[model samples]
Target: MKRYLAYYNENHCENRNYDVVIVGAGIGGLYTSLMLPKNLKIAVLSKKDIYDSDSCMAQGGIAASIQDDNRKLHVEDTINAGCYVNNLEAVNTLVDESEEAIESLIKLGVNFDRDLKGNFYRSFEGNHSIPRILHVNGDSTGKGIMDALIKEVKNAPNIEVIPNVFALDIIEEDNKCNGIVAYYKDKFVYFKSRQCVMASGGIGQLFSKTTNADILTGDGIAMAIRANVELDNMEYIQFHPTAFYSQDFDNKLFLISEAVRGEGAMLRNSSGKRFMKKYDNRMELAPRDIVARAISHEIDKSNSNCVYLDATMYNRDFLKNRFNKIYSECKNNGLQIEKDYIPVIPAEHYFMGGIKVDLYSRTNMTNLYAVGECACTGVHGANRLASNSLIEAVVFGKRAAGDISKRINYDFEDNISTINTRNNPPNKGRQEFDVDFLKLRIDLKKLMDSSVGIIRNIDKLQNALNFVDEVLFKIENLKFNSVLDAEVYNMYLVARSIIESILNTKDSIGSNYVEEYSRHSVV
Candidate 1:
């Protein structure tokens, strides 16, 4: 890896080389970078600043089985929530390693909330049988964890943090990933590395309304597809049960944390009547797929755009203390947590599938790994239990680091010879931003929201696939000069992949509800 770096720097006009290249500065990428051997050079790339990621926007806590012998229960809950389609081995790996992951975070200076007795304060979330979801600063869990990890990453001498770098594609030779081709600092740069990890979060931006950050345009998934990497279960998009409905057409939606529901909030219809009992006995505490589907059904029956989450029944002081971030956000939006009924609706929240990987988080392509939301290890299966995402990221991130460290010195001369290299040269002439491209992107989002959203059927899936095919062809002919152009192209690829996956899947399970299979019972 060091030799490749020197060769690239001397032969091609490039910045530098690294032993490992991690795309995305979120929790998974940062954790993996921190876990790697300190002697090896690593580069962490971010599309924007480090803080601009879905990981930092997460408000829910991280789940773990803290009690002795409770790992069985945790695994059971996860598999049950996934409709029994979860990979048992991968789920066990996640649950078994969760304690160590939390300890690693704490050792890295993460200040999780604790009680007077010095035990960690764990909160409950939807589908969690116990109060094992660890948080920090109340509802500001993601921000707290991100701040600590960013600090540690900056202090690590061996890791190079590069911001505003958009990875366009992975450079492959002989079925091995060598590095990435990225646009950075107004030039196309080739970053050579022996191992490449794709932790670039989800594909939520493909929808019209989502809780994901604007930068998540599915670049990692698209690049992987172009490289012929295997993908799985793209149809299982989790719609968060309660995103604050602002009635505005925007991608960024304020998430009303499931912690609020866990604390006894009621899901009420427009007539001020509780309705979740009609769907499931667990009510608001049910898993996300059930809650989201129930909420959607309620909205359809009442002919309303949204429902209400009534948390006012709780003590005012308790509400404020437990969810200060949510309280402040609601107040800023002209609603009071203790007085007004929060208008909420389901929105695209989590992607349970991406480049398929194994127990070690290694993709089929050699020298390549994927962790976080971009990798489908089959732990999530058809639906992700609440708060499992963060823990999965941390656990697999560490696993990927450990596996790479064991083979960092392995000879790759034969693999290097089998690679077919392609160069993406920097743009010479300045290309003006095209308004038509912006309109096309908007149209694509609307199409996904209407045809490929929460509820689907064969006809709808086919229509979505057709639209994606047409738009993708047009996108291939367009030239890119700005990050938005590349992002739009990636969005097209992501949308097509998702639609294709949905069309191939014939059953309704978990978050993916196809009308034809609606009568078939799940699990």
Candidate 2:
């Protein structure tokens, strides 16, 4: 591993340069940085603490066709789950490289759980035909993986992990990404880089309740929109069918991993009767889109806030051993997994649309790349298959790193000549009107949840778009002093994009269920 030297300029706001600047310190950013040539100077930025990412919140394991399953079957399952709208090349790339990604993680010291025979323990998830998902610490897969990757990152001399930094915008000149202007250490700073990787995760925070971490405010997608980069599939937002229902209605919801259902937990109505059989023949093993919609429909019909997931039939010891975190959370919340039914509801979970990128994770703009939830590689087209997100992050993250390394020294000086050197300062003025960000955030969440959520219609979509447009107008006029203000602005942009996308897409497919289109006609 070679190390590159870095120097700071006299101006405090300018010239903190790096060979590569990766926005968002989730699995994608961390894995990409680790995979990059160690000779290049890399900077990984996180809006909050590095560990406070959606990746760390993932309870289910990464999916891969590593055991009795084959890559072809995995690819077919992914495409089928995506309503056959997935980009074939990207799907192939993801499936073909999944084993390698898993192996790389192992080499980096990710301690995946193993059985008595020293074989990796694999579990099943919704929509998967085979038991291909791998876990760690029974169910704390994300935490285990992140702990290892974080340790590896800290030991890498060429990588710098900067926390409490907000990337405001991607700085582009002459149609090429030069770097980013971000708020760091209570001041705005320009980080010049040869390449920029946008791995800033998803937009789950826009909704009132989500499995995503609070830090996920669609920063990467919003920045890409600002940079005039291509975005796609914005209408496709995956709602997990079984997030724990709480009366507090907090933005961060605890996800009851789909593996629970895969392991024989049954979705039942308030009357303690099984319900999924009516929705789909696959029952609890149906794809996430179907399951989520079923739950939403059940709630609407029953006029109840949530349905129940009955896991009492499973052995208590097995339940505790396999889903210790979920069991403990339920116990702490006054619902024991072994004796009581866990209340569950559908909540916004994953975004399948974002800054559009090619198979190599290269965005439309030069010197820019995106991976993870922030990048639409078309691998998870209309809806994502369960447990595929973690593997997608590792696969595309490595591809982005590899592609960037190959093109790292491609006459950057010549390209620099085409860029205009201009210093854009951050807005420092306070607004005359006091905007209630909390109220606006709540309003936005309700608006999206009611209109553009699991089910959609033309009228509701239009109403949501109109509301978002009104908020965007106000956000543009307001001046911000903190990163929180910027986050609100970004949320407005992302929410607007999603509403607009739903309006533009005419057909119902996968998670995007438009009322105008017949389900049989599309699905």
Candidate 3:
């Protein structure tokens, strides 16, 4: 793994120092930076734009225990959805602070939808006993939250948002993290900081069909793995039950939010026969794992590529207003939500496993933290409950910011000006980059989708592991020059690790692969 590290010279590198270096610019990173004391210099690096994050793609809104909702129910629902494998302390922390997380977002000018009475227009989603999911502008909660946060980030004096900077590795010395090795304009940019945060989203792009952004290639996760950070539940990958099915598998699939079914949509086979009754008594509102498996079963039995989401019971005007994003997407594809059943199939949607972290979002390593989808904070166990990802991001982000603040003056800042660690700097590795990354990525996605999709057997897992070995062998001599090359390597590392974790898990079941508690670490 050391042979594959990002290269740099102690003398030729351009060193940029900050009080704190955040490796991602998603909701978690942005909120963490904004929450930090304004007197501190903060730098937020984005692989693409700050807007390009899984947090920014969330449409179903954040979950919180407000009003009639109780923290007990929220925690239970989360634990239940996670197959009771969640860390009790982390679950309690998320639910106990859920309201505060929502309030913080609102205070930051996130205009959640409200009725004329000035009350929150809360909605329903899969697996929840009540309508606690809050949205903004009907179906654009993610963009809405990101818009407000981006505006706030722009307005903040001490926070610097650096776009198009790809974080390559974590810089550490004597088992303590120092900063990040990043790539900008084809040069090594060493970010010297007292603390570092990995809010760099999830490992979604490793699949053929996912709802994640193109830039989400698990860079942070790979970096953590390279740094020997303890990872948890890596086998528990959550596939959403409703991504709009498409023939063109190259692009990021459009996700049909679970809120659609929460709003009374029914699942039907291609023959127009309702199918949920055969899978679960809950029908259209089962947990994502159950629903995705049911859909896969139906697809297998019917010999079709997709099932239908029948939202026609609602009038066009109502659907247009409530799910305008989905409605417009269907319309663009020559389908009508009011007149036709929208074609949907389960796709790789979210990663439940990530860099293991405590309630404070601190990883096993010192002065390092991870939040958002990339952090396995024990909130979402084997399977995530709907609408929890966004709230979980901000809640843990706030905690990480507070913890960093407490430890800021606690740790000494970089002594010398230029990223000059007292220890010897990392040297460049010799390699080749003569292959086509585009083709490698496409083929890798195909293998992951086929082997580790909604259904998996031990045979498939072994084959996938073999494929990972083959890919690694082929790229063993490849040079890490371009961002695409870096991302491909990250994807390969994450893919291999996830497959290995799955294979390592005893008595594993279908898509909702659970692990033995022996693999988890609690702080």
Candidate 4:
């Protein structure tokens, strides 16, 4: 969680000629960085330490079809789960690449959970017909995978991972991405590359309850919108059915993985009722959209603070060994999982809409590419499946890299003007800009969480958009340097992009429940 301070100079860099400049250090960005051709110059930018991202915070395993599974069935399940709105080409590509991505991970030394027969163990998640999810160390799959990738990336030759580099906006020239204008420290530094990839994750942190890291504020999505990139289904935010409700943090919830349901955990209400059965026949095994809506419906009817997840079906040994993280966290909070039922409720988790990109990861902008959760490839239409987030990041990250390698090189004009600053020459003074801008940022996050959270109607969304529009205007009018100012500006842009997108979609579908619009039709 260490935050570094850096300054970018308009002039003093030895290696300014790069083929690609990526604006995130998460798995997607890092994977692209590593998979890229060794001869091509690549730079990865991050606002904080590389590992400080939602990729690391992910608790579930990566979903893929490996042993004896059919890609056609996988595609069918994905399309069915997404309510048939998925782009078949993209779905096929993602489904087809799942095994390769899993094998790639294993080649990178990722220690996936294994069975007694010495096979790669898989588990079943909601809506999946088979045990296709390949987990690592139970609930710590993401952490284990991220650690391996980071180690491999650090030793890579052609990649430069620049942490604490905040990408303010995409530098688009003549309708093509030239590079990005990022503040490295207090100074506004410009990196001109032919290709720019945004793997900047999601907007979960903008809400009150989420399982994402704080860095998941839709930065890349915002920057793309500022550059006029097309965003699809912005309102399709996926709220996980049950999060461990914390009474201590004013009901701030933490994730209790869907795998618990796969292992037979049931959802119960205050009156000791298994309410999910009343909503869907699948009960706890229903898709996240149905599960979340059912829970929301129950809460409305009961007028209760939250629901409960009964994990008593599993034995104590299984709970302690398999779900150690969930067990310990609950115990530390003065609740025992084996005895007391875990208090829970649905919370904002994943956003299924973002800067729309094609199968090659190219967005509407000519040279700009987007991957990870930040880019909407029309793969997850209404609701994202249980563990497809990590898979999508890897699959698209690879495609973007492969496509970028075949493109012609971009050359920036030498007459680029630098931002005016006087704290330590034009270069180092950029680091001296006011850090208090980060405080204003906290206020922006509060606004998003309060207004644009799980359940939204017309009035709340319009109000949220109005506030965000004003904030964006204020940000444009402010005098600030590269460091915190750039990051805040980027966040504001992403917030507005998401809010605006959510406002445009009329119907209530999936995680996006619009009370005023009763229709579930998709345009």
Best model per lDDT: 2
- Over 293-338, each residue of candidate 3 has an lDDT whose tens digit, in order, gives 8888788878999999999999999999999999999999999889
TM-score attained by model 3: 0.94
Write model 4 residue lDDT over 103-153, tens digit each, in one string.
988898899999999998888888887888888878888888899999998
Per-residue CA lDDT of candidate 2, range 104-176, in tens?
A: 9999999899999999998888888888999989889999999999999999999999999888777787778
lDDT of 3 at 125: 91
From the highest lDDT down, the ranking of the candidates is 2, 1, 3, 4
Poorest stretch of ten by lDDT in candidate 4: 1-10
User: Which window of ten consecutive residues has the lowest lDDT sum in model 1?
Assistant: 1-10
TM-score of each: 0.93, 0.94, 0.94, 0.88
Q: Distance from true position, residue 296, model 1, in Å? A: 1.1
The model with the greater lDDT, 3 or 4, is: 3
Query: Residue 130 error for model 2, in Å?
Result: 0.9
Clashes of 1: 3
Candidate 1 displacement at residue 321 in angstroms:
1.2
Question: Against the unseen true structure, what C-alpha lDDT does each candidate score?
Answer: 0.85, 0.86, 0.84, 0.77
